[model samples]
Target: MPFAQIYMIEGRTEEQKRAVIEKVTAALVEAVGAPKETVRVWIQDVPNTNWGIAGVTAKDLGR
Candidate 1:
């Protein structure tokens, strides 16, 4: 089994998130030789206010 956890600042469309999940699953299947059915992927959408970059919040950076 292969598990993937992805963290990113919130605000992406549902389509984009779906793409992320699909692509991640495919990548894991290819890289680790895991069966597609055994792959797990989850996305964590962090608020811009809670995500920091370069000592500044993503919200403050206009992310």
Candidate 2:
């Protein structure tokens, strides 16, 4: 089974989230030869305060 967990800030349209899952599953199916049923992806949404970059929070980075 090719399983993946992706973490990102919450705020994407359902379409965008679906696209991510589809692309990841497709790659796993093609490159790793995993079956469509065996390929899985889980997206974990975190708050902006919990995500940071350059020692700054995502909210701060946006400022």
Candidate 3:
């Protein structure tokens, strides 16, 4: 089995997240020869307030 964990700031639409999962699964299947059904992808969305960029929070940085 191949597993991928992705972290990004919150606010992506459902469609965008879906695409990420699908594309990531395909990449893993092609790169590691994992079966499509055995590929696992997890997306962790961090709130802007909780995510930091340089010395500022993502929210403050307008991310």
User: Could you say which candidate leads in TM-score?
Assistant: 1
Which lDDT tens digits does candidate 3 get at residues 1-63?
888999999999999999999999999988988999999999999999999889799999899
Global fold similarity of model 3 (TM-score): 0.95
Q: Which ten residues in a row have the lowest lDDT in candidate 3?
A: 25-34
Flag regions of model 2 displaced more than 4 Å. Answer: none
Winner on lDDT between 2 and 3 is 3
Model 3 misplaced stretches (Cα beyond 4 Å) = none
Evaluated against the true structure, the overall lDDT of model 2 is 0.90
Residue 10 CA error for candidate 1 (Å)?
0.4
Q: State how far residue 61 of model 1 sits from its true place (Å).
A: 0.4
lDDT per residue, candidate 1, 1-63, as tens digits? 888999999999999999999999999988989999999999999999999999999999999
Q: What tens-digit string does per-residue lDDT give for candidate 2 at 1-63? A: 888999979898899999999999998899988999988899998888889989999988873
Ranking by TM-score: 1, 3, 2
TM-score of each: 0.96, 0.93, 0.95
